[model samples]
Target: MPDRSLNADTVPAAGPHDVPKAQQAVEERLIDTVLQSFADCEDPRLGQVMQALVRHLHAFVREVRLTEEEWDKAIEFLTEVGHITDDRRQEFILLSDVLGASMQTINVNNEACGDATEATVFGPFFVDDAPRIEQGGDISGGAVGQPCWVEGTVRDTEGSPVPNARIEVWEADEDGFYDLQYTDDRVSGRAHLFSDDEGGFRFWGLTPTPYPIPHDGPVGRMLAATGRSPMRASHLHFMVTAPQLRTLVTHIFVRGDELLESDTVFGVKDSLIKDFVQQPADAPTPDGRELGDRTWARARFDIVLAPA
Candidate 1:
């Protein structure tokens, strides 16, 4: 007890590796414990996924030396995301899109089959049972924007027309808002129609315009905090399906959009970028539906489906 108050000479000197080695061991042990807990998962795939997830998650936390406060903040952010999600709004998908996770998953699942239209992110705005339209009918459904004539032919990988293929199209309006984003029960800028016997279809829709992904929520906040823009390149969504053919979900991005290189969702593909030919106000409309003085646009997107 008389010598308990030790001087520097009496105290043990610490090596540079000593503290880190002990901390590393503790972190590894925790990771091992979490992995073991998932070992008994009934599904083999689930067990594999859970174990891998735990490993990576632990590694991330360790690499960053994540603080308790940071972890708590993350949980709080996710809670807000869940709270804001609903049938019409999907904050999680927005998060995944912005993080490039959505595009990565799409790239993994969608193999590059020769000449098949490349697939892209299935955005959060698609809704089932969209109003059907006849060939060359208007899909605008009273949504406001510049008129655009969209036409395309559905074909198989073998270069043959695929008739009766169902095409679902949806997009945001000039204001960068989907029909579902409004307060009322309104449906516009979305419709579904079947490819004709000749595998051809056309519809009047709005000219694809640059729009921000819903940026008034937690995802928006994250984008701001990270100094990232939420602007998506102008695009038109398409989901084409037919019997014995692989269903294709993709978008046609505006060819010259400045944001094409930095689309918030990473949804642009070189093959999917197409020219939207501009028309003079006096130019005749595709379906002879006249717009007194509005300058419209036209885009042709030929789709090639792979065998299912």
Candidate 2:
């Protein structure tokens, strides 16, 4: 209170105790000044986040002796990332993916995977509320490469079946491209389904294939600059929710997908991979198409949920 405005700019003269005192004084003042900037924020969460962000940003600038040129380049990169975002795509999520921030967040929040199935990253390609189908149904309604049959049980951590559970599933075709990626006329490989009284559901779809994520944007360029691949491993996406249960969103990777070791988004987990093999032509399918003649991959994976 003693003329802080006047004293703030005046550094103590160099002396035996002067350096330490000056350093402490500067630290205290910097913290106060930074926090004061956020004191006007109405939301407590926003204020806390802004203050922490500023503290870390300033600390980084000081610690690295950050160059103005480097800062400008960073600003440019961030602006590009923001500018490329829209309803179907989010560059920030892509940024988080490349930096491994998204996986770290998932790890921190989903640390309780003792016996329940392990959780994995949620990719950005999902469209909420797919059309609902029934057990033993097929989600893939478009051009399928290899017919795949996926049947699974929905159960809680205690091994109890979750009745009437809603299971949302989607995946890329054998070509590593989603339905949305193709022309507007295709719809063979997109559908949704629900569980039964015994918490069982089944679906048929095409075998997923290793494919590249969208690489025409800045994230793609960044990956190229870093010499990293832009391919996501073959996998099936599922989101399950029911009353009194923890909602789960995850992927069931196809074993031996080429990109399993190097998924562009780092979403692959060894535990998430399952056997998706080909069946003979004698197998009964809703389409009644000969199986091996066209090469099909069959997979059955059960999801173990956490109690609410």
lDDT of 2 by residue, 1-308 (tens): 23323254455432222224466577668878988989999999999999998888776665565679999988999999899887767788878987788888877777675466667777666777577777766687756577788888989988889888888788777776777666564655667777888988877777787888778888899899999988888887888889887778788988876778888787877779998876666666645655545555677888888776
TM-score of each: 0.92, 0.83
Worst 10 residues of 2 by lDDT: 12-21
Residue 278: error of model 1 in Å? 0.7
* lDDT (C-alpha, whole model) for all candidates: 0.90, 0.76
RMSD of 1: 5.9
- For residue 206, model 1's alpha carbon misses the true position, in angstroms, by 0.8
Winning candidate number (lDDT): 1
